[model samples]
Target: MEQWLGSLIKSGKRVVAPVKHDDIVDFAVISSPAQVADDYVQTRLSAKQYVFPKAEVLFSYKKDGKDVTIDDVNTDEFPETVLWKLHPCDVAGLEPLGAIFNWDYKDSLYNARRAKTTLVTFACAASDEYCFCASVGGGPGNTDGSDVQVTMLPDGDALVELISDKGKALLTDDIKGETSSADGIDKEKFIAKVEKKFTVDEIIKKLEGSFSSPIWQEQSDRCLGCGACAYVCPTCACFDIQEDSHLHGGRRVRSWDSCGFSLFTLHTGGYNPRTTQSARWRQRVLHKFSYMPERLHVTGCTGCGRCSRACPVDMNLVEHLTEIASHE
Candidate 1:
């Protein structure tokens, strides 16, 4: 694994992997295998930032008297990147995230980054209380969006599955080991058994008529509206565009936003559509469970449990969704 990572770095690809920082595990660019975190169940944040950054400048502009000049961003300059050690749930999010960016109009910025990025995922050998990937069409060994899938065996050897042409390209002859058949390997025994809480179809069917349900109010009463859930979520693509202007020049920037914020639905006429936290919370759930699946043909969540884990309040998504599914 170290040799392969080193080879990618030597080939000019930016290798980003999970790194431990005190109690927080997050993705960071690494030059050596020693820097990668080994004991983490999940990173504090997903690898989505590499493809879709938290904040990015779309274009720059300059004003000369009455004349305004616009300089479009160069997508050709985006760096080649490899997201290593990502789990199946995190990789699965790329499908929905990409759908949102490409459905209405082709997002050149997102496409550029995504085209240059390679996903190297490690199958989950363990899971925690917050995990529920199996409920949302994903599993510990699922490789929905991974370029390469690496499953570690009990004997310290890894079972490398080349999932795409890009994945095969990353394995050089020097690092390629003797290929062996996985015919008798019980992969299920090596991976975590995340219980399926509620299927996507169940959640979608329940949410179809749950708009006026009082459950939203009951579930969101303790929400702090801090947007921490969206910030850590792998599939949350909501963002706001703003102009950073100076005396003669400025840059148009896109920054992350959240539906959980009270002001997210505020109108320009001082009228707020979602005035309460309950409505905002409801939008978050319905959008992911009902709207995205209906419109994009893909669910907006991968059952990563990052939102529940990042919430300051103990608001578990799996429990909430299960309750919604059972609601009459």
Candidate 2:
């Protein structure tokens, strides 16, 4: 794996992998294989930033004496990239993101970046209690959105399975290994070792009647309104746009925002729609399980469990969903 990564980096394609940054492990561009972390079950942030950045300058404008100029951010600089070592669930999380971006209108910037990247997924060797991939129509080895899926055998040899033409193009004749096929490899058996926490049908059914339930307030009263959950989520694509202007010129900037924050729904007037934490929390849950599935034909979450793990106040999504399921 290290040899393959080194070869990719040497070929001028940017390699982004889970690398250790102080106490947290997040996806970062790597110049060498040594920077990749081996100890983390999941990264602090998802690989979505490679396509959708945290903050991006959409366009810049300048004015001078009845003259104005508008410039778009250069799309030519988006590097040919490879996302390595992300889990299959993380790769699947991109599905909802892609749907929303391409829904009403096409975002050419996102499309350009996405077209140049290839995802290389590593099957889970183990799963923790926080993981609920199976409950959300994904599994440890499910290759829903991966270009290539690599499974490490018990003997430490990796079986690289190409799932797309882009994945096949990545491997050249110079890349050598013990070549084999995925003829008898039952990845589902490997995934079955992990226990499922809930059923998707049951949870969605329970949510059908939970629109006005007081359980939202009960669960969200303890929330600190930190917005950490959405920040770590791969499918949360809400963003806020702002214009920074000088005396004569300015630029429009787009930055990520979250429903968990109090200021998210604040209006210019002294009115707020989703005013309380309970309302915000309800939106978060419904957006993932209800609204997204109904409108976009895809669950807004991939069940990677990053939101639960990153929540400082110990908000457990699976526990709340299970509680909602048992209500009726």
TM-score of each: 0.98, 0.96
Candidate 2 residue 36 C-alpha distance from true site, Å = 1.6
After superposition on all CA atoms, what RMSD does each candidate show versus the true structure?
A: 1.1, 1.6
Q: Give the winner by lDDT.
A: 1
Candidate 2 TM-score over all chains jointly = 0.96
Displacement of the residue 220 alpha carbon in candidate 1, Å: 0.5
Which pairs of residues collide in candidate 1? none
Off by over 4 Å in 2: 176-178, 188-192
lDDT of 1 by residue, 132-241 (tens): 99999999999877999999999987888899999998887878665667777777788889998889999998888788999999999999998899989999999999
> So what's the TM-score on candidate 1?
0.98
